[model samples]
Target: MIKGFILIFLLGASATYCIAQHNKAKSAAIIVTGKVLSQADSNLVKELFFDGLHEKIVNNFQRASTNFNKVLEIDPANDAAMYELANIYHTQNQEADAERLIRMAVTVQPENNWYWLLLADIYKQTQNMAQLVPVFDELIRLSPANEDNYFDKANALLMQNKVNEATAVYNSIEKLYGSSEDLSNARQRILIQQGKPGKAAAELEKLVISNPSDLGNYLSLSEIYAKSGKRDQAIAVLQKAALADPANALVRLSLADHYRALNKPDDAFIELKVAFADPNLNIDDKVRIILSFFPQFADYKARAYADELASITAKTHPDDPKAFSVYGDVLYQEQKYSEAKEEYKKALVLNDQVYQIWEQVLRIDITESKFKDAITDGEAALAIFPNQAPLYLFSSIAYAQSGNHEKAIAYLKNAADLETENKDVISQIFSGMGDSYNALKRYSESDQAYEKALAADPDNSYTLNNYAYYLSLRGENLEKAAKMSKRSIELDPGNSSSEDTYAWILFRLKKYADALIWIEKAMISGKVVNAVQLEHYGDILFFLGNKEQALLQWTKARQAGSASEKLNQKINEKKYIE
Candidate 1:
C-alpha cells in the first residue's frame, strides 16, 4: 500500500520551495541593475532587520509582501527582505513572484551558504543537476569545515552521475576526519554503487570494529553482507547488533525477516513475538508480525498473542472494553467456545456498545448449534448494528436446524431484504426454506418457496433437480417435472442427482422403454450409483419381458440400499406372474 516516492513527497516539499526561491532571487538581482546591499553599515542593518524578519514569519504572503515592500522602500539595498519575501511567495506556490524576489536575494548574498544549499535542493526537485553542481561548489567554499555540507555536495554530484567527483569529496572528508563514522558509512555506499562490494564490506567492517556499539553501523554491515550473498555473515552481524542493543525492535524485526527468508518460519515467529513485546516497537510492525504467523498456527498463536496484547494494554488502560473483544477473537479462533463466550460477556460488561463483537459471539454460538444462545446474541447485534447480514443468515440457519420453520423463514426474509443483490444467496435460502416446509408437509408454502428460488435463477441446476424430483415423488406435474429434469441434466450432464432425477421421472411416467434407456444412461454418466435408479431399471426390465434379469437387478438394488424391499417381496412371492 505504501510506495517508494512517499518519503520524497514527505521531506522534499520544503526543500523544493527553498531551491526555487534561490533561483528567483539570483535572477531578480540581474534585473534590478543595482547593488542589492550597500557596504556602509551593512552588519548593523542585517542585525536589526533579522529580528523583524523573524517576527514577520507569522504573517501571510499578503501581509508579508506589504511588509517586505516597506523594508525595501526604506533601503533599496535590503537583500534580507528580498530573500524572506522570496521564501514566503514560494511557500504560497506563487512561483513567478517568488522567483523575482529570490534572484535579488542570491545576487545580494551570492556568497551565502544557506542561499546556495537552498538553490541546490530546488535543482534536485526539478532534476536540474547541471545548475546544482556549481551551487554546491560555492557551498563547499563557504563552509568547508561543515561535514554535512561536504556530504550533501557529494550526494548532489552522485545524482548527476559524477561518480569520480563524488568519490573524491568522500575521500577528502575521510582524510580530514580520519575514518569518521559518517564519512566511512558514506564511502561504503559509494563503494557498493561502484561495484566494489568487497571493498564496501571491508570499509563497514573497519567502521564497526572502531565503533562496536553503533547499531546503525552494524545494520549497515548486515545489509552489505546480505546483498553480497553472505547471509550467514548477515545473520551473525544482526545477532551481534541485537545483542548489543537488546531493546532495539528494528534490529529484532530485521533478524526475524532474515530468519523467515532462510526457511526457518518458526524461528522467525519467535523473533516476531519478541519484537511485538517491546513497547518501543511500532504498532503497525507488531500487528504485521502477529498476522504473519502460518494460517495453521493462526488459531493458537493469534489467541496467545491477543491474550498477551490484552494483558499489556490492560496494565495501563485497565478500564478499556475493546481489549476484551480482541481477546475474544483469539479464543473464538481456537474453538474454546465457553472461554470465548466469557470473554465476549466481559467485553459487553465493560461496555455494551460493541455491536460487531456481539455479532461475532452470535456466529460462534450458531456454529456450535447453541440455538437459544445464538438468538440472544443475534438480537443484541441487531439492536446495535441493525440489518447486519451475517446475523440474519446465521440466525435463519440455526432456527431451521432447531426445527423452528416459522422463525427460520422470517429470518430468511429479513436476510433477503438486506442482501437484495445477492440473488444466488437468496435463492439458496429460499431453497432451504422450501426443504424445511416440505419436511413439515406444508406443501403450498414449500411450493411457493421453491417457485421463489426458480424465479431468482430459472435454470439453477440444483434447484431444478430438487424441485423436479419433489414433483415426481408427489405424482403431480409429471410433464413439468420431466422438462425440469431434462434442464438439470443439460446444465450438468454428469451430475449424479440430475441423472437420477431424469431416470426416475421417466419411470414415473410409465414410459418403461424410455425409462430403461435413461436409467442405463444415468449409470453410464458415471456420476451416481443410486439404488433407486437400479430398482427402477429392474422394474422397467420386468415390465419389458425380461423377468429373470429383472429379479437379479432388484436383488442388486436391494443390497445397494434401494427402497426395493417391496419389489423384492413381490418378486419372491411371484406376484408378477404373467
Candidate 2:
C-alpha cells in the first residue's frame, strides 16, 4: 500500500516538474486533461475522482481516509480534499488526526479565511472555546473589512456567554459600516440581553426616526418596548409611526392593533378604515377587521362603513362575490339582519357557485330559529359543494331542528362517512345525530349516537357534557354520567355549560352540597352568565335549606331570561323579607 502511494505521488510531482520546465507543453497537457474531465463516460478521470469521493462519503472513516489520501496524491493542494479527510477523522473520533490535517490545510493556505473558519468550526464542535477565540480572531484579522467575518465572530462570542465582547464587536461593525440594519439590530439584541433595554430603545427610536422609510425599524422598536413591558410607550411609538407614513397600509394596521390593545375601538376603526381604503391591504383581511370593529363602534359608524364596503365591492370587485359576502358579514355583525340577507342574496346572484355565502345565510336563519329557511339555504349550499362537510353538518342540524330526524341522521351519516380521518368532524356529526335522537325521544338511538361520538373523540368536552346531561335526564347511567361530567369539567374548567352539566349530574345523584359548589362556579365563570344555570343553582340551594339565597338566585335567573313555570312556583311559594 505504501509503495503504491509513493508511486502515485511521484507521478503527480513529475508532472508538476515537467509543467514548470515547458509552459506550452503544460498548456497542451491541461487541454487534454480538460477534455478527459469533460467526457460524459463514467470511465473518465474526473468521473472516477467523483466516484471515489462518493464511495468514501458513503462508507465509515476507514474507506474515507484511504480515498481522501489518494485524492491528495492526484492534487496535492486540494483544500476541499483535505477538509473531507479532516471530517472523516473527526467523525471517527480521531481528534488528533483531524486537528493535524485541518491545521496543515490552514497553514498551507494562510490567506484563506474559509480554512480558518473551518478550523474555528472544529474547535466549536469540540467545545474548545479558548482555541475557537484565537482562530476566529485570526480569521477576522485576515478579512477585517468583510461584514460576515465580524458578524460571525460576534455570534461566536455571544454563544460563549461573552456578552461584553459580543457587544463591543457589534458596536465596532456598526461604527465602521455606518448604520447597517443587521449590525444595528445585533447591537440592540445584545443591549437588551445585557438588561440595557433603555439604551436599546433609544438606539432603535433614533434608527426609526432617521430611516422613516424603513418600517422594520419602527416594528423592531415597538417589539423592544413591548418586551420591556412598556406597552403604552410601544403603542405611542406605533401611533407616531402611523402618522409619519399615513399612506403605508401596514403602518396603519399596526397602529390599529395598538389602538385595539389600548381599548380605543373607535380610534382603531378609523385607522382600519384608512388602511382598507389604500387598496394595499388584503381585501379579505381588511373586510374582516372592518366587521370585527363594526360591532364595537357606534351604530352610525357601522352603517357608514357598511356603505363604504358595499361601494368598494361594487367598484373594485364587481365580478367577485366575496366582496358582497364581506358586506353581508359587516351588516350581520351590526344586527342589520334584513339588509344582511339581501346582501347575501345579491352575492349568491352574482356567483351561485359561492357556497360560503349560502352557508352564511343559513347560519343567520339558524340563529333566528327559522329551521325551514336554514334547511333550504343549507341544501342550496350543498348543491354547489356536495362534498362540503360543514354544509352537510348544517343541513342535518336544520333538518333535526325542523323535526325530520330521519333526514337529519342521513345527512350526518353522510358527513361522517366522508370525513373518517377527521375525528373532530366525525365527533361533531355524531353529537348532532345524538341531539336529534334525544329531541325525538328515541333514548336507545340517542345512546348509540352519543357512544359513536365518544368513540371518535374520547375527550371531547362538549360531547361529554351534553351526553352526560342527557343520561342524567333519562334517569339511567348515573355513575357513567357523573364520571363523564367530571371529565368534561377537568378538560374545560371555564366552560359554563360543562360546569352546569357536572353540577346537574351531581344534583341528580342527590349530592346537593357538591352540586351547589359546581353550580355557583358555573354562574361566576361567565360575565353574561347563563340563566338556566342560575335556576339550577337556586334549585340546589333550595334543597340545601338555603331558602333566601335560593329565591335571590332564582330571581336573577328570571332577569337573565328563565321564565319557566317551576322557577315562578318557587318564587311564589318562598316568602321574601321586607
Task: Output the number of the lDDT-best candidate.
Answer: 2
Where does model 1 exceed 4 Å of error? 1-125, 131-150, 171-180, 242-283, 286-364, 403-414, 420-578
lDDT of each: 0.71, 0.75
Per-residue error for 115 in candidate 2, Å, reads 8.8
Query: Which regions of candidate 2 fall more than 4 Å away from where they truly are?
Result: 1-145, 174-176, 179-181, 204-243, 257-262, 282-358, 364-384, 388-578
TM-score of 1: 0.58
What lDDT tens digits, residue by residue, belong to model 2 across residues 198-281?
A: 999888878887788788888788878878888788877777777777677877777777777777867776776677667656
Candidate 2 lDDT score at position 111: 62
Q: For model 1, where is the 10-residue window of minimal lDDT?
A: 2-11
Every model's TM-score: 0.58, 0.47
On residues 1-578, what C-alpha lDDT tens digit does candidate 1 reach at each position?
A: 31211111011222223345443323211334333344554554555466556556666456656666666665554667877777776666665666556545665566666666556655665566666666666666677777777787788788877889998988888787666777777778788888998999898888788889888888888888889888889999999988898867778788877887897866775676566557655554444444444254546644565556544533434355655565566566667788778877887888987777777787778767898888777777777777766678777777788888788888878877787777787787778778777767888888899999988888788888888888888988999999999998898888766777787788789787887877788777765566776776677788788988888777787778765458668568733432
CA displacement after TM-score superposition, residue 411 of candidate 2 (Å):
5.8
The lDDT, on a scale of 0 to 1, for candidate 2 is: 0.75
